[model samples]
Target: METRYDFVIVGSGVSGGYLAGLLVKSGAKCLLLEAGKSLNPKSFPLSPMDLHTQSSWGGGVEFSRQGNLSLYRAKCLGGGSVVSQALVDRVDNEILEDWAEITEVEAFKPSNFSNYYDTVEAVLRPYEIPRDAWNRNAEIYLKGFEREEYYWKPVKRAAHDCQDSAKSSDCIVCLGGCPRDSKYNSLTRSILPAIQAGLEVQSEVEVQTFQEKQDHVEISARDKNGALTHYQTHHLVLAAGSFGTTEILLRSGLKKYLPALGTNVSCHPQFVSFGMFEEIVDAHRMAFSAVTSNDSKLRRLGVKMDSIGIDPVFVSMLLPGARKSLLKNLAHYRNLASISVSLRDESNGNLSLDRSGRLQFDKPTAPKDRHRIQQGLNLSRNFLLAAGAKSLLPKTQIFGLYLAGGCSLGTDLKTSVVSPQFKLHGSQRVSVTDASLFPSAPGTYPSLTIMATTQLAYEHLRKPV
Candidate 1:
């Protein structure tokens, strides 16, 4: 095995892919690794009839601590960006300023990150949806909410070639992976560019642990053949998603020295309010995440809605789908369903591991947050009713465990696991650039933030390496 590399990046999702691109462009030798398969968007299916085993929800790794079943996520090359709703809202300038001030890291400048955001969006080819293409469900949602003068606005999404399909929802196959290839997965955009830069990214290579040594860090992983392989490097960047990064670190036994390491892991708690409409509200017509509510009241309530779709597995998971009445109710999926409420919750959660270094999550939400869930439920119920929904069965897809803060940045180690630039507590050449390094859970989607932070960290990496 090649025992040395100039830079080692763990996880090829948002952060890792972006950072790998930067390093490769800088002419640095870097190795990118992920514990997933590479998917071809062209291979995905087109209609609701296009699902089964190899399900995004089947045998997928889930990290919920709430006792709720694990939610589906990408175990593929592009990471969640391939499976995401593709919602890319900029970080609120106020939120950015506050985190930088608190962490004493002036580099969190909104302008710096904003430029990165624009670059990424242009690369992804983001665009809004046309009204006529909205799934019938989404159309009903618009009518119902509009009647109430609700302040919901069309959501900005990353997509292409939105062909109107009377048989398919706008983002009908979004979670299964975008069939139209309109969705931006890192494999095609970020990872491809990084690969073009001559950076090497190997799939099925799982990093086991790391040991700090003389002027270098030794890393080990299991290759495609399941044999242990070690790679040494002067620099290491961990852009693994929240769960992957935490699991790797906990396995490395570094969390013992870094107490705050896996403690406060959380994610955006999402709940779906099933609006069973009377018309074939083709909820799958527009891009996933095509609209969002502007009511700060819901924000104040800690509940929010975004453009979303419903396939049966998710429908079974998040809606009252198992109930016979709900099943009978769902028979009208052709005319039923509209929008999903992807809540940005303020719940505290934690990450833990077994002696074997296997990962787990556990976080019981408080009543306050629960109240917000109820409030949103009520609003969704009202809308579904207004839209002529016979019955609105609201369910939660999120385990209410939107994991965050595992390696927060702050002025002192007691308050954080890493510095503002994402250097770990006791290491110079090791850095974390993914969601795990987020100072807090971003109110909206995290892809853009992950990309920006990677740019910032890679700039630092380019300086010395």
Candidate 2:
């Protein structure tokens, strides 16, 4: 086992991938330990149906369970960037101000953070949806919002030459993985650069715990064959998303000392609403989540409405509970256009390990949060009706997509896990630079914001402690 390195990062997701690249460029010996196997960019899924098939490198999904709330996330090298729709939005000014105040960190100020944001944007190369790529489903919302005089705009997405994905009839599989290598996932865009720069990566390694001393930290991980290996590094960074990082700390007994380790988890819980129109609407041929509402009224309520892409498999799952009408809903899938209304929930939850060491989510949508969801649903119905829909079916099932804030940053150690600089409380060499450091849930797409946070952490990582 490699016993010495300048830095060891857990999880090769957005933060870990980008940080590894930066560190390697600066001549640091870095090793990235990823739980999932590395995927080849050349073999990205060709069609939506290709997602379920096993590739040379394996990709899988894990679910966060509570009672009725189940959150699905990617368990792979590229993490959420691979499985997401690639909707890239920066942190809202309001969210930034909130972070600055909560953590008392000047870096969160919009002016100071602009440099990091610009750096991330340059790398991501996000762009608005082109006119030719606007499929019928996306257009439905655009036309409806225009008619209703509601604020709406084209969504910015991170991708390079996505024309093929946008033109394909089976493009709805984007949420699973982009086979064309158009989407700017970390594996192809960031981690590969780091690999070329001499950064070491070990896939299929599950880190179990960390033994931190004054000068170095030792990590114990189980490899694919269940063989445990101990690796040592001067610096340890955790970028394993919110739940994964929190679970690690909990398992390592950090939660006993820092009670805030697994609390204040927030998610953008969304409900999907379907509108059936007489005209045939092939929603899958466009970029998923092509446009969203920007109305101030909705923003105050922490609600955002965006167009959604649904393939046959997902559509079948969301079919009405009535068994008799299941086939009827399936038959109209082609003619139905869908929109998702997601709310930035105010009520935060907690993450805890079950008796078997499995991570469990205990966040329930608060009544106030549910009210905002209803507000979003009502607005969605109005927009769908404006699009000349013959009928509307709004599913009230709440599902969370963008997860954040399990190990949040704050000035108060009693309520937060990390400091404003992304350093874990009571530790010098340990830091976190992921969505888990978000002070609270930002009320929009958080992919870009999460990346930007790592940029901030990178700046601090260069300074001597």
TM-score of each: 0.91, 0.94
How large is the C-alpha RMSD of every model relative to the true structure?
A: 2.7, 2.3
Per-model lDDT:
0.69, 0.80
lDDT of 2 by residue, 1-465 (tens): 576899999988878888888888888889999887666656556554455333212232234464445465556778778877888887688779888998888888999888889999998989997767777888899888989888987888898787734546556656656767788878777888889889999988989999799999989999989999999999999998887788789888898878888888987887788999999887766666678887887788788888877777666655546565766777887898989888888899889899998888887667897778777888889889998999987474566768888898887988899987778998888999988888788888888888988988998897764
lDDT of 1: 0.69
Give the CA lDDT, 0 to 100, for residue 220 in model 1: 87
Best by TM-score: 2
| Superposition TM-score, candidate 2 onto the true structure | 0.94
For model 2, the run of ten residues with the poorest summed lDDT: 52-61
Count of clashes, each model = 26, 2
